[model samples]
Target: MNLEDYGEGTLASAPLDVLEDYFAAHGWQSERNGDEEIVAAVKGSWTQYELRAVWRAEDRVLQFLALPDVRVPEDKRQLVYETFGLINEQLWLGHFEMWAASSMILFRHAALLDSASPAGLTLQQAETLIEAALDECERFYPVFQFVLWGDKTPQEAIAAALVDTAGEA
Candidate 1:
């Protein structure tokens, strides 16, 4: 279905379709996973990142996840864990997590829709979340590289990744 189908003020009850359509409209490749999930992929400088959106009908929440291609080495798990705390605190939306079993790191964000209606679940909101997730991934990826390969401390890595824009404004 197209985005225009859900006009302003109308409840976007189909969370999965809405997410899929929104991503597809932006030229991102997307596909359904089983019944409740849609996975979309976008290319980045380092690698391709997979963004997954899962619709929880019962809870009325759409969960967005972006999995970077980088995997934390077993030896550097502790360092990465510590770095995640620093990164998460600076974030205004979503958080980073590591899956021990798979040795993979992921960025996740979620939006809760009104159970009675989709008053706040607009296409613009969905796009904003996806854009934020991707931006966060791009920004922090180098920090992970520093911890894993450059043997830098979390503080050093964060400091290196941060860009000072005090005078630009």
Candidate 2:
């Protein structure tokens, strides 16, 4: 099925349909806000996350932005920036970036799709991409909470949040 089959006024042939299918299979709340963008709200251990995926067919890139929904204050921007660098270092895929305009921290990743493939993206590929972003978001969520609300230094936040607890507490 193509985009046009979804409804009237929508056009055909976009890669994000695979992403939309992923959302449907998982039963998460998501919507296609535009021809190339889909936003999904997911619940995590620490907070609600907004996952946004954009398909750029011309570039054959499906860009994803995962938001933990915590706003960084102006004063904490420097520490947040520092923590972002630290957290991103440990991430094998994707990275953290601060939107200076909105004082928002976001996790960004992208998948290079095969434009030649009519299927665009497979369901497995969609899950892998989206899950990896969310996993990163959940893993380091406390670091942001520490710096933003607890007023901890970047070093302290990372240290405290990443403590490797063994067995059941």
Most TM-score-accurate candidate: 2
* Whole-model Cα lDDT of every candidate shown, in order: 0.84, 0.82
Candidate 2 residue-wise lDDT, 49-70, digit = tens: 9999988767778899999888
- Model 1 residue runs over 4 Å out of place are 1-13, 118-120, 165-169
RMSD to native for every prediction? 3.1, 3.7
Writing each residue's lDDT as its tens digit, candidate 1 over 32-139 gives: 876579898999877799999887767778898999998988899999999999999999999999988999999998988775544335677777888999999999
Best by lDDT: 1
